[model samples]
Target: MTVTQVALIKMPAGNEYFNLLTKAGIVFDYIALMWLLALTNGVLSPLFPIAYLVVMHATIYWRTKGAILSSISLTAGYSTIFAVQAQFDFNTTFVFILNLVFIWIIGVFGSLIVIRERKHLKQKEIFHELMFTDYLTGLYNHRHFQEQLRIMTRARQNFLLVMGDIDHFKQINDQFGHLIGDEILKNLGGIFRDLAEDYDAQAFRYGGEEFAFLLPSIEETRQISFFDDLYGRLSSEKFSKECLSVTMSFGIASSKSGILPDKLLGYADQLLYSAKANGKNQVKFESRYTYYYSKAKEEIAASKQ
Candidate 1:
């Protein structure tokens, strides 16, 4: 207990015995936090020092920001306790001043720690940069697509999975050569990027001839309007080489209806294959994901009848 000569601060309890006990309890809490900070040899030993700092910091911080109450309390409480423990064998004044210097020094040290951690994180990210970026198209590869799909699924955000394959892409590659095919893919990648931006979606190159998308928080109306704009854009978009027109068939499935990523992917793939089977350049959204299209179809039929 720090039996300090506190002048004007009177105890709140009415009974004298309870006042002593209350003072003792406050001192015990102060002593516990102080003991953790007092050890000089191994300050963060057993990782208790950070815990003490957190407890005291929270107490003082809820009082006021930029107020040095925790630091002040820790220094004063621990120094007084240490002086008592040392039985005046220690120079308490010098020790208190030394602790103050270190507390200020640790503030600078904390800033350095933050800077170092950020730099290390950036370096780590550079090493982990995705290697499977499609140079011609600016989209992720098949591996990246699967990895990202798993990530989004685990995050449990309402998402839409779409499979897009260029209509007659191989024919374009064969007839115009790989250079023109590359240009076409880049042009289409630009369109996909634009589409993803407008809808807060992500695009991935699923394979040499296919692309994928994960569109987050897409409701039925936004979903239909999204694809409608996409289909319209690709149908009318002009490529740089000889004013060529690019078109793609997209198959989409949504997570709002509780479709898992793998099954949703399969659904979109099936729709894409069916589109190829039916003829190219059109979209098919299946798997209870027909909210917008179904409503549109109903409205149109009602209007006609």
Candidate 2:
């Protein structure tokens, strides 16, 4: 197979890595300890090398499962050394047993610390999700939307702001009860999720009955077909056993509007209001030049007068 295909095939199963770098560090530490043991053989205190051995195994235990392997390998290495020493003097056997016990104790304590650290990290992830996710629609919440706007503004990336709201959402709630209205919201959220994944966009549930999208790196010319497809899907969606159809109104503003993120949101929101005012189930989109041109013409007329 081609190199590219082989690389793809070898992709890790999960989003996390095994931390091969940490493993490499462990290997280096093992080699350094071996070198120290060789240099100090039958000269200095054997306890000095034992201290280094405990530290090396403890370091690996702090992060991963390397502790057990380190413990086993160190035990076997010391056993071999003591066995040779026993040919001359058997007194080194006591130190061998002590070495095994001390290294394992350090490994166990390091494993405990690693467990606690992982638990704390998992809790933080859960809290972050709760803080930034909308419970009802399972989409990014308004806080996350605001944060994303700030990030996009700082990065100076081009994006299109699309505001959408269900048409007569309150009427649907009043007519069919809030449950059906909720189902409609969920269905629309699902549609938005799929669209966002397909188009490399971010979708947010701005508030009750309102949703927003950030279409990153998309050109104005690419929006018309997307809006067309979106409207088609929304209009044809049936949310209830009665096969009730729902519609939504959208307003889109391009990055060419040259407005701040907050202003982009406000402008798109205003256009959405205009859609609702003119007629429901329609989209209203405008470039920055349209409003700028109108304002300039009005100023020119006023100056002439």
Candidate 3:
């Protein structure tokens, strides 16, 4: 199966169905354990209730609060059985209360373990977000872009890699100061996010004043209008408190078979330079012939060696 199909299959079911199934399984398992203990109690020692406490530990997977609730219910059910066995004897009644205390201790320990597990999971999520997200603009960082490129390359999927750099960014930073430059970057990040969403594309903040876009399965004819719309939106967008107009140069390269991610990005970067050289605030695209030419060059070099 394809990676996309596998991903869809592995995705979690709805929360409501999961919760119901889990709770029912927990309840049924506990009930079965209780019945087995009762049936075997006569042949076993009276101290067998301790086995019930050990069984309660399984509830730990339900998390801290859920485990505590399960523990309470278990205590109530086990205590009822113990009280019946005590038969009004002082010594037996004392032992029953002692066993109950031990059960609560087990419950408390299980809850503590669950709490720690929860905290660890939360930390992992936070670390993952920090790793993949840009601090300045909250966009997907370059590291994530590398990962996306790797996945797409492995799958042999075709996509357009569009690189954009703000026009005259250094001048803007020099004239308006770094803080205003930062604000402009933040605003551009938002603009890219909106445009990417509208166009069904993935966007990233490549670094500094640079950004990247991945447009999957976009047709050659459609790409022109898409870039035109993107150019229009960016040109019309205001920046700084001065409401100054801002523009960006874009370079786009489409994936071809046998092309590596780094090479594609480099080609796009070259196109970006071309856009800036010709005049800023324009879009430069790769010719399909370029890939064949590069491939032919590689073949020629390999044959000569």
Q: What is the per-residue lDDT of model 2 for residues 111-169, given as tens digits with 9 covering 90 to 100? A: 66667777899999989999998887888999999999878876777888889898888
lDDT of 1 by residue, 64-119 (tens): 22124445565566556555555343455565456556654443444345456667
Residue pair clashes in candidate 3:
none
| Better candidate number, 1 or 3, judged by lDDT | 3
For each candidate, give its TM-score against the true structure: 0.52, 0.64, 0.62
Give the TM-score ranking, best first.
2, 3, 1
Which 10 residues in a row give candidate 1 its minimum summed lDDT?
A: 58-67
Model 3 Cα shift for residue 81 (angstroms) = 10
| Candidate 3, superposed: residue stretches over 4 Å from native | 1-107, 232-236, 287-305
Model 1 earns a TM-score of 0.52
Tens-digit per-residue lDDT, 181-263, candidate 3: 99988888888788889888988999999999999867655676566567666667777775377878878888888789889
After superposition, candidate 1 runs with Cα above 4 Å error? 1-127, 256-260, 287-305
Error of 1 at 65 (Å): 39
Clash totals for all models, in order? Answer: 0, 0, 0
Candidate 2, residue 111: lDDT: 62
